[model samples]
Target chain A: MYVESTGIQVIETIEELQKTLNRNERKDTTVGFVPTMGFLHEGHLSLVSHAKEQNDIVVMSIFVNPAQFGPGEDFESYPRDREKDLRLASEAGVDIVFIPSVEEMYPADGGIRILPGRQADELCGASRPGHFDGVLKVVLKLFNIVDPDRSYFGMKDAQQLAIIETFVRDFNLRTAIVRVPIVREEDGLAKSSRNVNLTAIERSEAPAIYQALQSGVEMFADGANPEAVERQVAEGIIANSSGKIDYVKILAYPELGPVTDDTEEIILACAVKFSSTRLIDNIIMSTKDGTPCSE
Target chain B: MYVESTGIQVIETIEELQKTLNRNERKDTTVGFVPTMGFLHEGHLSLVSHAKEQNDIVVMSIFVNPAQFGPGEDFESYPRDREKDLRLASEAGVDIVFIPSVEEMYPADGGIRILPGRQADELCGASRPGHFDGVLKVVLKLFNIVDPDRSYFGMKDAQQLAIIETFVRDFNLRTAIVRVPIVREEDGLAKSSRNVNLTAIERSEAPAIYQALQSGVEMFADGANPEAVERQVAEGIIANSSGKIDYVKILAYPELGPVTDDTEEIILACAVKFSSTRLIDNIIMSTKDGTPCSE
Candidate 1:
């Protein structure tokens, strides 16, 4: 499958991809899928690398999924540079890159969509009406298309990861979900394709988003009340980054519930806007002993 | 996996079943899954036979899914006979019978569920609320758990089959759905596990249900208006059986949309109740030239 030293299969049609994967499947090749919305960054490459390490072949998708975008969102303006993405994917040793068009992916005006259950409404889903649903639909479609042995996602988007975990568990998807640790820049900003959209001034200030989340985690560990931590985090983001805060909440980790004193693991999550650019960051807090708490 | 002459592997947990299947998966064995409720009859056996013919190994599940049953819709009274089912599955050459308890299948109370749009609102779904949602949930779960190359289903539950087909197609499930043609009693009543609930008198009158459907199809084929065909089907059922009609609707096949002039394939479906016994039957009609007309 990887005969080319620098060349990788660039599959555009779903039928061709399925046929190729079916051939590999008959030979009992284990597949790992990494779904991306184009404009590949180090974060995406890390996922691809993880996939290659774990499975026999890695299939990466780079369609700027239209379904996940809402009205007035960056669907049309989302970053795209296919040549750069292809270069990165080849360097990461990807087996295939599936690139489908808007028409090919979403032909029907209104087709099947996955409804995000209880977990979707709190963070990103609260602002973007049907964002999580769209994400679920596309990912589910990709999972079916690739039928991967394992699928990789970053812990950076904790809520999205949690939702996918639930989707796979509840639906009994045998494709095991492998959650990769979040990759961050030296300045501590979580790596994202959207980070490319940040202006020079905004890029420098965006690191404060992660910095604020870290402060909240530290406060919680220092025995501060959940409310106090929430307040400090919100004020820190507004003060340091000069970004409008969307939400700053202290909640139970992985389970995504309200924070109580006895809550073993907690997620300090928030979203902020800087000069019209929206960014999100979070950190998971657990007891110093690092015991497994809420999964 | 079979260790005895009548020794079909009986797995009680999803994890154990997955482990066994994973071993076979690594060996490149083609797995076919047949999901069912207990009290296995010839109809269920037929599905098993179909799976056996197409796959290297067959796995059948017998769990009377409670979620698919509406309140007061015979969930509690649903029949079960483990010993008998085991014997039947063994005789049918089933390789494995997964009999999971409700707790094992649905681990959490407030968990994820599917929201079936469009087609779910008609036919049997019209009479039973959340019926298709429950069916989709369980079937999706079973698909995930088995991760089979193919899943066999009887066309007897036409609406259920149609909905599952749509679910698999839309969700991008790779498990090919093999629709086994409807199995029926010699007297023409479609064989169902529910037939056990019928009293002697009701059982004697049940064949008329299928007979009335035949009359409706004959009338429609003879160029009766859609409304007239509906009337004839309803009247024929009431006259021939002592059962109260739940619904008698002639609709487009597969999509389950309302019947119209341009409808290409037709599904003449009905549900009737005698005392507490309910029975459903349907006939699919299409043009001889294979033009898309009614379904």
Candidate 2:
């Protein structure tokens, strides 16, 4: 595979990206964007793979995005391997790699900031204060800079993808947002760079996350109540030798709604802290009454 | 001037706009939008005029945007003149007039919405709860429907304009927002559809709104302190035979900040209650210290 390290040519600043995209816009070229936080995991590659298939030119952005991380969070220690990531991205058939510095993304005295509202008050936003606002702010900045025809996002960050979909719908974003299914490891551990932080033993037990979620789905499939399905999933996770349940509540996907008997989608979402590494996993399954059962 | 007496195509459904925009997207034509609450005054015409100058196609939407109005406020009695607005917009060169019903915009379920953050919380937002949110929600809907290359807004709604600018910048909206200067009556009353409600006496007093604002600007030119300038403007408005000062203050133009000695590009904004009619006016002025001054 020919690996091209775009040392200043591909995209360095917002101006450079805008120039490239604007030129394409005039010529009517279809541009696609895949935004990634950089560690080159299979999950991110899946999104890139989808973007490459859909558009004439694919632009992949690899930035850690500090704003998305909260106080005492793992922003500084977030996994990054530029040389390896570039090699993987280049191999994945990405047309351009947009590597922008923090300074480039956020200028000094930048007054512009995006604050997500009520919907932002739920899901991951509830735990990580200012997380979605940061996500939205940067995503918007990237979208404006890239001005792509279609943007690709992986379902691994399910809530993030949902929020972006809302952003696209609510704000009338011009770019079409294409969502790809979450890519997982052979054992069903959702592919994540955070998987790197797991110990060998912890990694073996990690598939239990998916297993618990599946159990909840199976219960819902077998005609159990949504609450019963949620309870079962929580039980399964807590029963795991290495898993400590953080939260395994059933909610409406994206909206983070409470379980309602009348409605059909109750997302079975779970967060578990394992070996000082926190992992979140969820499943959206239709229940007997038509609610989502996320085990 | 060509006049199209197009009947109000008042459809509140977002799905329809989405479908229309998607269809338009296939043709790849430049689209421009002017979002307005139904009462089309000269202020709105300036925006439509600017939009006409910039884009291949123009869309002017008329909705009273209830979110921008506070409870017990003018939501019920706010100006609604579809027939007149249509004639005015057509004369100003609007290509499409989107008149969505409230049920269409807010759906029966009223699920999904937009959030206009901190900047929106200040200024008019302080008096009007959820005003910017409503503005954002509708603007996003219109943007999606029109998929405009450029959109126009009048600066007479200064706070609204700033909030929209902040929203676009923070959200990474693809469309370029063009702000048109405020249009005024010969007597200097800021052109508003609401002006139609003024009685003969109220109409006569309306001009005082502008005169008071002008006095504030003149005071700044005379080396008056920011506090003294504000006092002069307040005194002028109250002293008017038919004017009742609602608010007379000096502040930074874009940020709506408190006036300091170093403020530049300041605004002297005033609102006066003339019997039952409320009139607002402002004058832009520069400070000696190169910072915005507020009156």
Candidate 3:
């Protein structure tokens, strides 16, 4: 299914990426970028597919950033299979595979944080600590290196997506930050490269996360109070088939702030554990005032 | 003289700036950006002059970022004369003048600090509190808007320059951040728009700021102990200056970290008060064995 070599290119250095992009930068051809830490999945593909449809060129970056991972968080154990990822990206019609090494991304004495303000401090800020900082830092670096006209991201990482949105605005970034819907497994687990690490039993129980989020969505859809919606989502997760509940929150979508009263848009989101693996999922719902399902 | 029209391209929306820049984004043209508050000064002019030399187009952004200003500090009272700044920038051969209103830079709701972590949490971090957060937030927005080939900053704002340097590296930003040498008054007072607000007595005492920094540089050059050099510099300012000493530090040059005896490439920097105004400056120095003055 691969077209002749003109369709896709691979870049590992800032200079090469810039040289390639420099040619198209002057033209009206829209370039869309999808940045990933490799180990590609349908979720990333969903972004790629959307990017392919929107722009004339699609640039996918596969650099597993170490800065985003905490002290003991999955920096080493983070699943990676570049061969598989490369094939999947090629199949998805990606125009370029910008796979930079750790040294390429961060030279000795490299320092920068692409994190956004208030948005990062909330939600995942507490859990991952420097997670959003790392995400924004890398995304920004990618944006500069790729110089894309538009960049696509999966909404599964709603907080990360929100922070990027803020970063683009705050930094006056040149690229458009486009967000695609969260692609999920048939059973409702939000698709992630990390999903590959889940044990068979953990994978089976993964759908409970979607179920809990769906229950919250349903509650909000049925005119439940925002507080009550949060409670119901937590209760639903606690009653799940397997795993410990890390957090069950019904927040304002997009902003990731606490949901107050019966907001027009509420996001039913959660993080849960099946043994050592952690999974997160969410659903956006709206109210009668025509507020968005995902705020 | 007056070449291009200057209306303070008041972009209240990030989307608007994106739309405008997208239409104008070009390759091969070096875009030089100089970010500042509205008040114009020779110090800022010096930066613009440097930008004009290397760039085909120069974009000067006048934004008094509220985030950088401390509470009970003069965020509201910060000097702003758009007409004056436009005239000065236009006279200095600027191509574009970007003067975004507060709402243009920040969303009504988002409050996240753009650059966070240990780098941000040091130096001015402990003193101004959220000051660096504000500086970074605004600077990121400015960079995004300008998307310059090389951005120019004055060495007068050494820590700010350091943070921006770190920001570019961490995010993998392609924009080259260039620091211009510090411009000083003939009297040795560091050129700052804030210098205008100083009382006559404070103005007379301002030269001591530079003098003390020079002494620190001389001491370090003469192979004096770094700590002793820093102490002498601080003591000199406190003894002769009208302003209270905020911080008199000899930091490792470029890194903006603390200096030890073995530190090389050091910067003797300080901020002191004169009545209601605060003035800051630094002199770059190197220790033996090539370590920054601060280690």
Q: Which residue ranges in model 3 land beyond 4 Å of their true spot?
A: A1-7, A23-26, A108-127, A187-189, A211-216, A225-240, A289-295, B1-27, B115-126, B238-241, B258-264, B288-295
- The most accurate candidate by lDDT is 1
True contacts kept of each: 0.42, 0.25, 0.62
lDDT of 3 by residue, B136-235 (tens): 7777767767667788888888778877787777666667998888777899888888887898888988898888878777777777776798799888
* Candidate 1 local lDDT, B1-295, one digit each (tens): 3344587898999998888887434466888999998899998999999898889999999999999999888988888899899999999999999999999998874355677777777778899988988898898888888878899888778888888888777667778998787788999889898998999989998999888888888888888876797788888888877898898887777888887767778888889987876888888888344332221
- Candidate 2: tens digits of C-alpha lDDT, residues A184-259: 7898888888888889989988998889988877777677776787788878877774878777766666565665
Q: Give the alpha carbon lDDT tens digit for every residue of A40-133 in model 3.
A: 8888898899999999999899998998999988799888897788888888999889888999888755344444566655556777888887
lDDT of 2 at B125: 62
Clashing residue pairs found in predicted model 1: A172-B144, B253-B295, B263-B293, B263-B294, B264-B293, B264-B294, B265-B293, B265-B294, B265-B295
How would the docking of model 3 be graded?
acceptable
Best by TM-score: 1
Q: Give the TM-score comparing model 2 with the true structure, all chains together.
A: 0.87
Worst 10 residues of 2 chain A by lDDT: A1-10
lDDT of 1: 0.82
Judged by DockQ, which candidate is best? Answer: 3
The order by descending lDDT is: 1, 3, 2
Candidate scoring better on lDDT of 1 and 3: 1
lDDT (Cα, tens digit) per residue for candidate 1, span A1-295: 2334567988887777888888334466788999888898888989998999998999999899877889998888788998888888999999898888877666553244568777777888788888988888888878878778899988878888888998887777768999887788999998888888888888988888878877777777878887898899998888887789888877776667787657677777888887756888888767554332221
